[model samples]
Target: MEKLKMHTPDLAEENYKKLAALFPNAVTETIDDDGNVIRAIDKDVLMQEINTKVVDDGQERYQFTWPDKRKAVILANQPIAKTLRFEKEKSVGKDGTPGGIDSQNIYIEGDNLDALKLLQETYLGKVKMIYIDPPYNTGNDFIYEDDFSQSVADYTNNSGQTDEVGNRLVQNSDNNGRFHTDWLNMIYPRIRLAKDLLSNYGMIFISINEIEVTNLVKACDEIFGNDCHVATFVWKNKYGPGAFTRGVASLHEYVVCYAKHYPNSIEAELSEEEQKKYCKRDNKFEKRVAI
Candidate 1:
């Protein structure tokens, strides 16, 4: 039987030399409150004292051994069956059926998060702009109830069919234990996935009120860096409403804009036609002074 012997080598001198070369401008002497040198110590000596040792032996070989290794077991669950299937013949429009609106490019649907996810494969990194008007997190504001554990049939039936009763709207109360937690969980994953679908020069405009502006800003900062913040547009929704006698009127909403990268790269320069439209006089001084 052969026995293994380990040998270690001292690396204090080499470490001291490396530290000295790395910190060329570092001062050696310690100064006092009066700006006087309390004590002088050699940088090389100080570094050597605290330096670690490295071992290198010609016969030494590193080997990792595992005792009582366990294998990972992943259980397969039965896939849920889908109930609804679209028939192409029934989906085709009849001869007398009125055509849909021409200028209606806007699509207003329920569960924007799910809709956005479904669009991921077809529209990833293709959207030039995205604007969302989410419900403000006020005490009485309504939130879309998304099922985390819903089956495919239930989700399809609920989304495809319209009920005469009305749309399902859930009120998010501040008093709820998981009010902020639920909101965060709902928006966090969606925002993370949305980031992947934004083009290099794409922009996202989010309309928010005073209630969750801070939280929204923080979340945006996390998704898009603090440097990517373009500007916060203040849109006046109400003009002259003085219902309260105590304070100033809160009649403005905020639209936060975040760019994919540096604003200079994404920002477009004024076109020749746009500049001509604003031209009031012939001289450069007149045009500059007009605004």
Candidate 2:
């Protein structure tokens, strides 16, 4: 049996049209709630009861029933994996072909989403570590146009395209309406797929500044699970001089680590050499062994 399949959900266009006809004014609106304008839903009784039967449409479809409050069919498919082929040119460095550490590592320069999807076949549940430094959707920052269909060459050559042009270091300010939505959409599926790529002992590290730290934690909690949380480390990235005017001088960043499974041991004892280096004085008897 095939282990993975690509899923493409179809929208019920015909059914939606029929439903729209029943309630011509089934439009979303905002109403005054106290002093604030809040979104309000208005629907017709007849439109709510209307149901459509599946016709002989060549498109793929699946039936999903909504909650008891309302009955609706959601057309969706099971996600599958497709094989991808590519040619790689062998490189000869100064010391001949780079081997050992460098040769084993694969550098795939393309859309990470598709790259990760293709990697699902061979690298599924095999990756030991995953570190991603994604874009910060602050209005001043340049947004990544995550187009899965584009080839590496097409993406690299298209200078005028938004996907290519906007993938740079810029400020993502608050004016953009889809700031949070765009960031979530870009990272959600990638993280979901990453979870499948982790081994039982594997781990993931996410580096983010204060701007998105909270959001990143929330996302990781949902993906890696609240129980798999390992630890959060604060790293001092800068030193001296620079200081924040509004608050305490910002010189550090956060690295959130999560495990794929519950660890039998929470901590590891330092090796003999590590103990000597840290303790300065050689204390052979004080050397501890792994539990």
For 1-291, candidate 2 gives per-residue lDDT tens digits of: 955446322224434565567675664556584677653335443445555443344666753211220111121112334444443454334455533233444666555665666676678789888888787554566655544457645764663444542342223467756566556555666776777789988888888778777767777787688788887778998887465446577778889888898586655667999878877644675644432
Output the lDDT of residue 104, model 1: 24
TM-score of each: 0.54, 0.58
The CA lDDT at 63 in model 2 is: 30
Model 1 misplaced regions, further than 4 Å: 1-97, 100-108, 147-168, 265-277, 280-291
Tens digit of per-residue lDDT, candidate 1, span 108-200:
344555455555555778877877777777776666554436664675466553323334445678997756655555555456556657898
Candidate lDDT scores, in order, read 0.58, 0.60
CA deviation > 4 Å runs, candidate 2:
1-86, 90-102, 146-172, 241-247, 266-272, 280-291
